[model samples]
Target: MNERVNGLSETAVKLDRAGLDGMDRAPPQLDRLEREFQTFMREVDEAAAQLRLKAKPIWFGPVKADIDAESALLKDERRKDPPQQEADAKIIQPERLDPSQENGKFAAGSLKSMDADTGPVRAQPQPSGAPKMGEAEKAEGGSSDVFHRRLGPINLADNLQAGIRAVRRNLLVVMGFTLATNVLVLAIPVYLFQISDRVLTSRSTDTLVMLTILIAGAVILNAVLDAIRRFILMRTAVEVAAQLGAPILGAAARASLHSNGREYQTLGDLQQLRSFLVSGTLLSFLDAPLTPLFMLAVFLVHPDLGYIAVVAALLLLVIAFINQKMTASAFHEAGNFQSRANLHLDSMSRNSQIINALAMIPEAVKIWGQDTAGSLKAQVLAQDRNVISASVSKAVRMLAQVAMLGWGAYLSLEGQLTGGMVIAASIIAGRALAPVEGAIEGWHQFIHTRSAYERISVLLKSSPLNFERLKLPRPQGRLDVERLLFVPQGTKRVVLNGVSFTLAAGESLAVIGDSGAGKTTLGKMLVGSLLPTSGNVRLDLMDLRNWDQRQFGENIGYLPQDVQLFPGTIKANIGRMRDDASDEDIYKAARLADVHELISTFAQGYETMVAADGSPLSGGQKQRIALARAFFGNPRLVVLDEPNSNLDGSGDAALLRALSHAKREKITVITITQRPSLLNCVDKILLLSNGTVAMFGVREEVLKALAPLNATNGRPAVASQTPQVA
Candidate 1:
């Protein structure tokens, strides 16, 4: 081993010293070998250059010594512990090599290359203790927390915070004006004191006139501030309502389709909150906080007066607490009953025709009466509690006034107080307790507002679909459903499972199913009206949830199982109730649905008025109008669910012609139906049963497959020209 190591070292040293010089001095064969070696060396140098291997100077002698020393160290370590082996028992130091220089150079070079590729190092994740930037901003800046929160996930505190933020500006104005108004109130008592002490005693006409003018000026100032404050609060309430009106209605409308609670209650909650904002009850609340200031003024009058005022204030507070404790639960129950009754009434009114026709009015009335009676009983109980507390509070207030008067007279007789001071002290003491008395009187209203706030809070917690998303250009009507599943809320039954399909642009497909087979639900999902529980429904390769709903709605048309027509003129209904819908667009849609001639039969033509739910218009007329509206704007994708349910022969023919025209225009159509007539126009068929696909293929193939089943059931198959599947 030592001889081999020495020989390698000698070879390396000889080559380094004499290789270039000896190349020319050698024989031809030796020269050829040396040149070939140099060529191979050059190739290696080029390969190393490509690999970015930088060469550093090193000595062979030190490397040899280090290897020998490392081997000796390992042997010694192994001999000391034969059971275990250590690969790095001792660090070998190369005396001729600078370890720091080589390691530092290589590390620095590698780091420079990586830094260029990856940029700067990223910071570590934030600690749990760190507050979110949005939360920090909300705390520092006065922004509505409710506005930030959605309707279903938030609590009452967040709602109150939002309400406070909404009226924050007006509240500041009101507080300042309230202070001014109450301060001006001081002018009245001061004037009374001066009148009795100075004007009455001295009999100075000029002083009396000056004092009267100053007091009148203060009264005018107080009235002006009060009016301004009231106006600001009123406007603020209107502004808040205006801002929240859309969100509240949006929530209620969405909730009505799914949520069990009274959907209309949200509207009432908004009304109650706005009324509270503008009501005298709110003003009294503002004044209640100034009760302490009035008591302090009374204290300045006399210690006896101050003590009486404190006792009166404390008594009113206790009475106020009793009033809330007694009436709150009753008020809450009454409100619940009232909302429930209202919901039942709304449902009844919408179905009044059926109720009256079936002679169900008596039974309906009995149920409504029960609800109303329950609500009335709760209201009466709450009022009774309120009246009792109010009577007791009034009695206590009267006794406090009488006691103050007696104390004042005694002090006056004892020569410790003047007549004017006695009068002033009594007045101030009453003023101190007045706000609390007012609050007790308005306790019922306060409770109602509190209830309204709570309901509104819950309504505001429901999060709407986020409309802020990447805007894509209009879709090409290419629909894709991938492994879709839907389970309705609060139900264990699945409506759809693993439903996967793709529909190309400009293709027509008919969805046919037995009753309760999720046909309507499928149509709704396709049109982006309802979301899938799992997987995805996409249009033009983009998820429908990510699409801007309003923008998507403009390009997509849907006629639901139950057709709805807004209260409007025939022209407006055909034009989708859009104010900006042109006459040409309206005429085109009406013509497309073949409703123009039927509409023309009316004396007023397009100007014919339609009642709510398209009342007074026949069912066929409403369905035709809805169909026209669905085709309005020439939507790229159209979904029709049971479109011909109420249509007559002429209406049916019109619907068929409309479908043909839509196909001609390359509109992708998905129609949910049970009729063979509509099936004749569709190119493909999808038959669903028990929430799974029974058969899906070209209309011909699906109809052919079902032929055998129909024959076995003793039912004739649909004519091949008008193929159908059941």
Candidate 2:
């Protein structure tokens, strides 16, 4: 055996060297042979190790028998005094005798597992210096417990702040450009001074040409710098949007699941914020700080010109303040009205078919017109105030320029200032007040952007991003709902109260209830779409909240009552929009839902386009396609609410076949329905009435129980119950 092992090792080394030397030249057969030889060598090594373990001394049997008997006796004693003896018991077994040794001597390491009827070994105390488990987990990231992974609610405000920090470098570059551009702008006034004092007095055409060329070059450079600053700001805005876009959309999607009739204006607010970033308003803010520098230039010309510039700036500032005070409330009110108008418009667009079919367009328009009129009225008021303030600010600025020129003229006549000084001071004074005037003009936009920022901040705080959850193994569809209770937000009515049920893997349950009897709510709770106000929903002994949402979603399938497909190819919709879904999986899902042949009848087949608003296809077709989507990816659990609501006879037969297929595949299913035909395909029935369980048992037993109730009431048990739950 040893000789064979040595020979194999030598052969492996020779093969390795040969493979490296002739890797490119080696034939496919040679590579295959090499792999086979390596696998054989591994098997030989394992077999040899097992043989060595089995090889023992002939005289070791008696000693092993004695140890086995002793072990058996110790086990018996432990059974008699189970708790105390099991805690304190430690058994010693004789070590395997070395095959080469004639004398039976134990190895040195054998004492570690042995104890001679000693009392329970006291656990070794942890060293004072060592951190406890909880402390270690905290150092890593709070507790390892599912409910307390973080120290407190996630600080989503920091997430928004972090996006700004990510673009800090670009902002700094913009600021540098702003400074350089402002300094270069001084060239115009300086050129005016030189042309008036030097060129005109000297009558030197050469000096005139030089000053024009120099000032033109400075103007061009300033334009180039300004363009670069704007480009940088635009890119920074895009980058910030990209950084926060996914997280914001994810939060909105989660918020939609929990709330009803709550409009999510986060995306629009983000767009407003981004537009403000790249707008001229931001540049005006940057230039406002350099206004004092321009004022200082005017001061260098003459103190009286400086004083005029200061007064103009002060007056403009006061006008801006008045504009803000007057228009702030109006703009805010306009924004609120505009949001409502947008919501109404979106609803009308989504239900355009219904409006057209019912000929309700006139009434819809009138309703939306009211909201639009309110928004327009508030906006018109705000704009009126803004225009008035801007006109006053403009008058103050032009008056200041006129005052500077007139005063300079008087000073020049009195021989107190030069003609060049008069012209330069007038130009410099206008530059000094340009920022304040521009700011006044853009004041309304500034107010809107500030309002958007505040709204976005509040939205983020209310709907924090989901925390990273630990990935758990795929569940086997063993569902246990224990005393579930749910009450809708901002309402006193209970939708589901003390609803409890259990379903094992492969079982099919029919959840039948009257309209508004909480069947849909129960289905949502089972699929993890809606959280229970109390009690637990466990899958495979693990709480639903403990599983990562993405992973949990991948394992469970859901089809809501209103079947809506995303705007995409039929193949994509059936594949649940997953880019990675294979052709085989798509075909299998369609076949399982009995939709494959129906889809094939279309001209484009699976490649046919579909819209969220049902188009081209009939209501039954949409329901069938949605059913296929639910069965896609072979989900372990499938929840279908009103699965057969739009199904015809043929579609109903297909659904029955699908349910049977699900049972055969051991995929647990919870079907919410009012139709009695589906109950025949299910293994069990759960009847709900007035947000409580009316009856729950095996199919025959439940039907038998309901049979007497039906007879007494002269109607079906479910249909007889009144709608009480929301």
Candidate 3:
């Protein structure tokens, strides 16, 4: 027994290196004899035959060699203990081997059983003499999965908090530059005081030259600091945009998929935030609180002058507050009206051809005008209030200046104030009130931006998609819907209910139903474009949600009822905008769908530019090209809705050929069709009616049952072909 074990081990080693060198190799007949010892090898051969995998001579030889080596090991073990085999069989039960253990040599049957779980069984290669994947492998960039950007809980507060964090990251440097610029601005008032007091009183050329030089230097320093501060703010805005861009855009896109109209407007809010960051209006608000510094300087000059400055500042602030209170409601209404008008404009523009064909342009124009009118009226009312407050604020500011001069003249006569001191104090008072005036002027912009921020914050806080999802391998296209139900958001109406079916790999099912029968919704759920409200849609027993969407999407082919296309070249659309899509696969898909000749008719062939929604092509041309895209990469699962709606006799023939080819290639197909001619290509028929399954059965049984009913009664042919659910 020991001698036989040693000989078989040596034989296995020789077989592994058989093709490596030109050594005179022994005939593999010795290994073939070993194959007769194992019952598992015979079971595997039968399983492979059931799968219908054609065995090429070249491929079969290598497989036989491998089986031979495995059999040899088993034969040597059996020789060691003939009687131990029956007893050891209890210990070597296939059920005891973990399905996930790839190293289990006698667990081949476990591979087939792994499909009982919710995911497809995929074979992973274990490199000979290689260490197992671990933290070291992960650190070396071995993981292919990526973590998506997560935008935490959707809400206004969280959005604001995110913004605050970004700002605080560089707040210290920004603050330093801001304070320095403000301090340099003080030099202007000080220089003016010295020029009036020292240079003017002395009336000396040397004193004037020295004061002028000092003031010029201070002005240059202030300019430099102001530039640096502006640069910092701009850089901060860019960084904030970069950090939050992906998450915000992803949230918006996800919301849009669920028909959240407000989500589309979220992008506008992001723009507003970016604009506010770079705008000087926010900076003016920041500097407004520093106004008291100027007021204190005035007090140092003379108590009477200081009192006037404080009263003037308070009056301006009162007018500003009045402006805000009067215009807030108006501005909010105006924003809502503007949003509706924009939405209407977008819809009308997209459907302009239909409006013109129906001669409804005048009606559309009137409706649009009405929407715009409401927006305009609100704007005008807000503007009227703004103008009134602004007028009062400006008049008070001018009045304060004139009154200060008059009061100074009186004080100078009494020898309580100098002329230079009065001039300097008035300038300080005006500087202190400048921010108030600026705020009033920019109040409307601030209101619009604030409203945008609140709307966006809410969108950002709404639930986000799961990032860092498990990366499951490609499915073999077995589809299962377990009592699935789907109800759209904010609606009690159910789109689909209690829909259950099973499609084995490489089988075709035809879904036949009238309008509003939930056929479209079923197709969407199967392709993972929409989620079921309850129950599950699984591929290979695993729920679709559990599978990584990006990888799963690569194995799926979907054709929507509307036949939409993006703005790009013909080649790009067919390739689904994949950068790695080969020209061979693209051309092969085009040929399979019989669109190659049609595309060649165009001046640029594959490079021809396609308008959005494939608007540049005729209905038949669009459907054919879309079919070609669905066939791209020979995807495992293909779901086509109303595919032949626009196709002519020739196009329908081409579609039939494509379906036939897809079946031959072992692709699973679920096609929704209004025409009965398509039934010949499908093996099973599913009839849907009013969100429930009317019938589901083999194609022949359904057609035979329905034909007799149609012959006896005057019922519609399509309905007659459908029997009650069994």
The candidate maximizing lDDT is 2
What 10-residue stretch in candidate 2 is worst by lDDT?
A: 56-65
**Number of the top candidate by TM-score?**
2
Clashing pairs in 2: none
Where does the lowest 10-residue lDDT sum fall in candidate 1? Answer: 140-149
Candidate number with the higher lDDT (2 or 3): 2
lDDT of each: 0.75, 0.78, 0.74
Q: In candidate 2, what are the lDDT values of residues 147-180, reduced to their tens digit?
A: 2123222445556776679668787888899999
Instruction: List clash counts for every candidate, in order.
Output: 7, 0, 6
For every model shown, what is its TM-score relative to the native structure? 0.77, 0.79, 0.77
Provide C-alpha RMSD values for all models, in order: 19.2, 14.2, 11.3
Q: Which stretches of model 2 miss by more than 4 angstroms? A: 1-159, 260-264, 716-726
In candidate 3 the C-alpha lDDT for residue 601 amounts to 94
Candidate order by TM-score, decreasing, is 2, 3, 1
All candidates in order of lDDT, best leading: 2, 1, 3
